[model samples]
Target: MPDVACPESPVTPPPPDTHTRSLSRTLPISVLLFTVVPLVIAGLLTLTEGAQRLREEQELRARQTASLLAGRVTQLLASAQRLGQAMAVSPAVLAALQPPASADRAMDEPPSRPEVLGDPWLALIRSFPEVDRVELLDAQGRKVYTHPPRMQESPPVRHLTASQPPWYPREDLGSIEIGLRVTHDGADGWVVVGVSAQSLARALEPPAQDGGELWALLRDAQGRVLMLVRRIAGQPPEVQPLPVIEALAAPDARSRPVVARSALDDSAWSVEVQASLDAYRSLVLAELLRFGLTVLVISALSAGLAWHFARSLTRAIREVARAARAILRGHYLNAHVALQRDDELGLLAQSFNHMSRQLEQRERERDVFGRLVSPEVRDQLVQGELMLGGQEVEVTVLFSDIRGFTRLCEGLKPRDVVLTLNEYFTRMTHAVQRFGGYVNNYMGDAMVVVFGAPTPDPHRVERALHAAVAMRRELAAFNQERASYGAAPLEIGIGLASGTALAGQIGSPERCIYTVIGDTVNIAARLEGLAKHESGMQVFMNQATRDLLPPHLREALQPLGELALKGRGTRVPVWGLPEGAELPEPPAHLRRPEEEIL
Candidate 1:
């Protein structure tokens, strides 16, 4: 029979069959997309919406401020024009600008207008501290009767050629002016009030809290830049002049990519809240940056989850694979994977472990049965070819006993006796297995060994005799080892018998043993027992065993005369080891019952 061997390493399982399949293919892509995509998309959308809303809000505030300033300026200019009209019609102006006694004032009747009008116009200019350099001009454009008489020392202004009755008088002192035609008897007189351009600019200055990125340009009706304020990032916003013109003309030209502008109708001026396109672009870019960062964070979290999920899933798969490979190699001992979750993967692992346990148990049972009955018997049974019932087959049986065992036990402790028996049996059992025989059972101090039951053996007798010789030689070496321990040397007797015998599994259903039975078995036992009677011989066989042995082994046997065996119908020819000077003699004190009977 061929030697049976099994493999046992997990570091290398059988290489998996070549295939294109992999975890990437098996794992779902939709799970990754669903887990990550929505968060990124939602962040982008929210950012975009917020940016747009903020832009509109900022633009609205700019327009509102411009409109508010426009209304206030328009009211200021109109009120100043009304003040000029009131001053131009004053009776004090008629007396002060005309000669000390003029004909137009009519040397008649104490003049139609008052000569000293209590200087109410100077009081009006004084009341508005913000107004600087207000002037009262005569029809000739000269400072006439100026308040505090200080204006009379200034150089004369050129005469006005444009003042007329129901007059629209024109005054250009290089300042924003609101003048009413000053009429006495429907004649034109000059009453001009000047508003300082620097003062106007200062009055229109927006609060410093407005961010530095904002620039406000106040352009007059002629599209001249009166004031500009840049409150953020330290650069004045550049704006085209034509947009302001369009603003002044249409009072509705709202152009883009130029400035966030509101035209002031009352002043015929455009309050252009100047900004560059980059401002809105910057907002959009900021939103995009925020979106990119959010995407990175979401992607990282999603990747972590994916990795954890994949690791957990593959761990179970690898465990099952390893256990499966072990089973394939016929090494199913303790082949179970453990998982502690309540998910579906855990259930799958549980089922796999259950299957692994079943296989492991089956492997254990078969291994135990193989050791008990021999591999040959196990193979036959596993193949379903062997019948349970007994069958007669020619077989050779050997029985052995430790010689002088009862005497040896008397000299040693119980533990030493058992140890010696175990060592002796181990050596002898190896001898039988080497010669293709199975040890069926061990009696105290003896072993029953057999050849050719689960397997056929043409050389059964030779093999059995050889095993006996081998065992005796092995025991000699074992005795040498024992001697080193100051232990008494041990010896054994062997007996062989060859004949047809009944061989099969025998006993109750719950417990059974594959063994041989019949006269051949009993005779083998009787031969071993006879060793005690026949001068404590080392080996003995019956005539039947001797006839079957090969010539060499046959020549090695020496005959003893036919003897009556207990429970036998007739005398049987018995055999013993060849006579030689080297053959051992029995110890003197121990002998057989038969010798005493004789």
Candidate 2:
């Protein structure tokens, strides 16, 4: 074919084979989305529901077990009470409560073998498997007779008068005495019974394979646990009282009636049950297996679907990723991804554009904030600036107040007063900053500044004194300037003190201000007040600041010896500087004992 002259046109490459590999990638992604995702979600739900059900079942089982065990203990307690009541009615026990015929015999005298009441009582107690020991006490709480004399002296018995009945405290078998009123039986003494805790423990033993543990305790109204028995073989029998559990026991309706009480003595007894969680271990294992199988099946299906869906999703994601990389490289306006779908992908593009705008806005705001606060301070705030703790630091605090700001404001327009004050602050702030002090805050016409904060300066006291002097001098110069303008000269009183203070940002997390709190700041404020009180001085330095300065500098300054300050118990030595004196060197110590100076 003859070559024909063709119109000039750019050769366009065939549509970059968009469909050639599209199906290849889309198929796997579709399979993953349809199969694996649903399976995984189903498995998670199954596992969660199964675990919850297992917990509920275990809790219900525990409650049931505790109730049953508590019932058994209740029965045993009731039996013990019945036995005690029967003993009260026994003629022999009643006879034992009477004083012996030979009242002349010493209380400790052993009853003649034939006359002793303990032998018969011992015989009777032995007949009952639960009675470990029995004893008799006289009105004086002395053990007149015991089945077995285990010790040289019975542990001191708590005296039980006619008003108090003889009954065992349910918690322990420790030496307990209860009075049996002789009046009821036509006698003039009391009888005490001591039962062995071991016998009670044996009596209250629970069934062997009951799947729960049971404990029996005897307590006084005070809720002391005197005896405890556990169903578990290897567990030690506990005799110590459980106050917390006992408190709960009394308040709970289900537990109150079952917890026994002795009618004769008014002593209380209780039982506790704790079901073993292991009781339902088999059920849990079975449910767990079912959960695991369901999870495995669902996970397999979900993963497959996810893998297939991921392939198609990756195409749109890759486009966004490529544009993001371009934007990160500083091509802010040169890069954008085409999000053709009206789904999450399109929303993401919109969000990304919004994020770009927000990021620019933040940059501008940061610049403005930097101007408002010092760069270092702004950085600290933005970067979690502090450890949120206070520290004792050597700081020089300065308090300055306009001498007659309120009076001056009355004469001038409000705007004029504000303008003049603003001008004053500008000059004072510049001076303070020059001396490496931070203006802590402005309180109406007063300004508080701290040296050696945020960052410490070794010569903080000297710097603060220098700043205070400079501030007064600047005020004079400002007043002179105002005088030329036909305005009254402004005067300010300044106070400076140096000492240890707790300095840090103080307030809530949402709003906080850096400040110092301590006796030093208070003293500085007091000195400022004193400045107004002093005859010819506008600045007052407390003994603290005066002592901090060198002796030569101290000599140059005029001392206002021992002036009493408000709220101070004793007079404080104060000093003032002449209108013009060279700045003094800081003393080694702000305070020294009078003897040391001598």
Q: Quote each prediction's TM-score.
A: 0.43, 0.40
Model 2 per-residue lDDT tens digits across residues 268-314: 44444333434445666786777667756776757766675666677
Which stretches of model 1 miss by more than 4 angstroms? 1-316, 325-334, 338-347, 379-388, 535-538, 579-598
The 10-residue segment with the lowest total lDDT in model 1 = 165-174
Candidate 1: tens digits of C-alpha lDDT, residues 417-457: 88777777778877677777777777788788888776788
Q: Of the candidates shown, which would achieve the greatest lDDT relative to the real structure?
A: 1
TM accuracy, model 1: 0.43
Alpha carbon lDDT of each predicted model? 0.63, 0.61
